[model samples]
Target: MQKAVGIIAEYNPFHKGHEYQIQQAKEQTGANIAIILMSGDFVQRGTPAIFAKHQRTAMALLGGADIVFELPSFYACGSAEYFSSGAVSVFNALNSIDFLCFGSESGEIDTCRFLGKLLADEPKLYKEKLRSFLKQGLSFPAARKSALAEYLKEKDIPFSEDFLDTPNNILGIEYCKSLAAQNSSIAPVTIKRIGSSYHETSLSSEYPSASAIRRELIAAWNTQKFLSDTLKNAQPPAVKDYLCALLENETFLIEDDFSLLLKYELMKNTPESLCAFSDMSPDLARRIYHHLNTFETFTQFAEQLKTKELTYTRICRALLHVLLNIPSDLPAISPAYVRLLGFKKESSSFLRILQKNSDIPIITKAADYKKLLPKEVHSLFEKDLFASNLYETVKCNKKSTAFTNDLQKPPIIL
Candidate 1:
């Protein structure tokens, strides 16, 4: 029996740091294969990926993943809680994975587990503190941290709430919480993040942040510089070549590309109606409606709506829900099927093992989804198709290329 480690990621643009993580994961766990559950066209940050999912999948396979599966768009674009729950649920349902590995600022699994337990079982004092902080107008994240700090202080727990301040640690805690909530058997592991901070915008380090790489790519694209020059040391050789080839022929997408589509969605809805979308609140809906006349681009609108209570990423996510017509009430948090994106040819036997062990269907062909999935699950799968086609349409329109519907495309067999 071959051991496998499960990784949840957005590999927005596969870089050297990501390649290092995959290598380290396999070595640390002594696993025969590393399976990745990655975000599709849209990521958790409420924006489209800088590169399309298939392109990114190719990069992942080349970088060292044995198999890559798409995390459904609903969860991919959701908050940390939803994203972690969805990914952990899929891993649990698979029943063959041995470990769930993630990167965090603090590489202590026990601390993360303790915090996860505290959060999952929100004690009375913690709840009251949370509400009191919320009443004082702190953002949900800030309020939660403050409440946890006070509660832990009273309980005489020595752990610092400062761990929650880092993005990866926060997400790692959410993963722990989800694993505990589902009573999953998969063990959790962490690798300390290296080189750069999550939001750092500098490209000087060997393991530059993805945000920095994207910013550099955008700058180079605008100035007509080659990707090789811009990302010479930041990406793995294969990924760099793949990206260079992609940019030579296709248009790389950015948030502003969907500005017109978002504007159209906004034009058709009222403040009351807008509140029906995921992450949309009464206040946010009103603010969006009030500022409709001043809207320019998706990025601009999100920035315009940002406030002390609402962070910029949250605003972007809410606006994206409106643009994509995602309802506030989702049918299920757990994914119905595992959608294969790409895999190495040598891993065919491992793939079969996964299929044999998985409780749900493994979707390789888009056209066969209706036959393989339940009615509700089929409907959920349709959103992924719609999102891909919409992304293709925008990309094609921008590049003056003919529209090739991605629905007919099968999983990439590397």
Candidate 2:
């Protein structure tokens, strides 16, 4: 069996930095194949991906990933814990995956692993401290960080909360925790993120953040232009056209893209009914309902609803959940299938190995999904299908073209 390295990513635009990570993972693990578990049409920050999933998958294969699998919308649109666990579960189910490669600000795999164990175990002292912190009105992330820092201090353990503070590091920690919880054999490889913070909105010659690129691309589109020379130089050669088309055609989807539709959904349904969404608290639902008529866009509404307790992103995500009608009570189950988005031509043998050894079904064709998946699995899959359709509607509406339905989209083969 050949060693295979797995990467969990959004690839929101398949930038140069992502290509660098793929190359580094292959070299560091000495793996024969690189597998990417990517978010589908929707992404974790409560927004649609800049390019369609198929375009992103093609870019991944062109950038050297051997196989690309979809992280379904249910998990793709979730919080860090759920998103990481979902991707890790898919990797764990694969028979040949050996190492999980991820980027982190700390670039310390051992520290991530230790913290993962602590989180998975949740010692009594840690839990007590966590409750105490939450009672003080800190957000979940802040509360957890404080509790962990306090616990580490009392135990005289040498650790840094920097991992918890940085976005990629926090996700890396969740990946490790998921691995520990599942008692999986996959080893973790950490690559230190080079240049620019995750949220930095400025371009860097070496490695601009994804947020920065998206902002620049959108700005360029709004000005009826394409990427400038410097920005173009920073993109992978393969995705340049995709990026250009997305911007030129105005197909880019942001959290604010669904503003009108979300407002309609909120106005049409009772505030109490929205409590069935995962992120919507009763108070939060009422707040959104109260401001539904005042704000013209989801961004405006989210900002109006924001406070020290509610971050803008959190409010956006919650509104998305409500708009999509995500069940307040999603069943707790590992992802039930692997949906291939694309793959390199040379990776045929690896697919065979997965088909033979994977516990979950590998779905390559959308039409076959219904026949092959069980009732519960099919139900879960419907959410992803609905999300894709909604995303297509947004794209077509933007371009004023006929719908390019995803049901007819065959997996892209490079």
Candidate 3:
């Protein structure tokens, strides 16, 4: 038996369900160690996490994972495909990771494999039919599922949404798809999600959604008012202090640190130039640019400009692509390196394994990265710069004007 298991996650705020997943992954695999690939300050849904990376990493460590690694912003904040690919790459680097574990709507690996195969084997005509359906008014996801199901039906492949529309399942499919594509030896597995489908707002005593918890925290509502019976074993970190730091003046990150660049990109740049980043279609940009002045914030702006088929998250990702100039080709080639944000003592062994087996360089510290890598690594540092700058710009009380202060400054936590 291998010494470790791989868990790809974003502990935006740890809760009962996640705890269950970690324990189950361990139980199912009979592996002693869990290597978690986590998103940094930003997550795939393109939002600042309620808690910072260190805190989340700390929570995972406190809960049970033997090691934690950062999933760089380049991959962390992108679409499902990129997120899965990045996690898969990191886990693949760790020859110790015998299993890649995740939570899904349906835990059936065979069904996931079937859908994963069809998506991988997408025929030329299938794409054409999908595009035509998009023209007739189907959303990209809807068109994709429709086209995929038609292909599956023709091939007599059995599959179901079992969870596609919900957020986690969508990413789960991508995970399976990525694993299949990479031909990784690690096995794919899923733990069916427990309660309140992804984004469900009401907080239940037994199975509250992470979104609900976030909403309560954002509203400054007391956790005692919403803590569930099942969550007794969960024990997330203190929320008040964390949120205070987030809402406080000059704490960690600021509001501008996030979408400000995107806002400016939308207002100042042309649709042609903006099309280069992740999922930035020209038509979407045309709509976004016109609505720029009409709304104030990204959320408001997306609300004002979004078509029925395009979700707020989808449009925001496009806008982010415009801001970062994240070309699709760039992710395909350049994001070969995985940046280490923060980790605990056990990570030393995991790092040794990664270094020994990884085909790509594993960057452990920012200062070292700057000294060793070329200017392109700046893309990675630049986003951090943007985060600091945006945070400063939004939180006026912060005295320091430097956005790059923490860059090459914050070393991995031992």
Better of 1 and 2 by TM-score: 1
Per-residue lDDT for 56 in model 3? 70
Error of 1 at 329 (Å): 1.3
Ranked candidates, highest TM-score first:
1, 2, 3
Per-model C-alpha lDDT, please? 0.89, 0.84, 0.67
Q: What TM-score goes with each of the models?
A: 0.98, 0.96, 0.85
For residues 343-390, write the lDDT of model 1, one tens digit per residue: 999999999999999998999888898889988777788888888889
TM-score of 3: 0.85
Q: List the residue pairs that clash in candidate 2.
A: none
Best-matching candidate per lDDT: 1
On a 0 to 100 scale, what is the lDDT of residue 33 in model 3?
A: 75
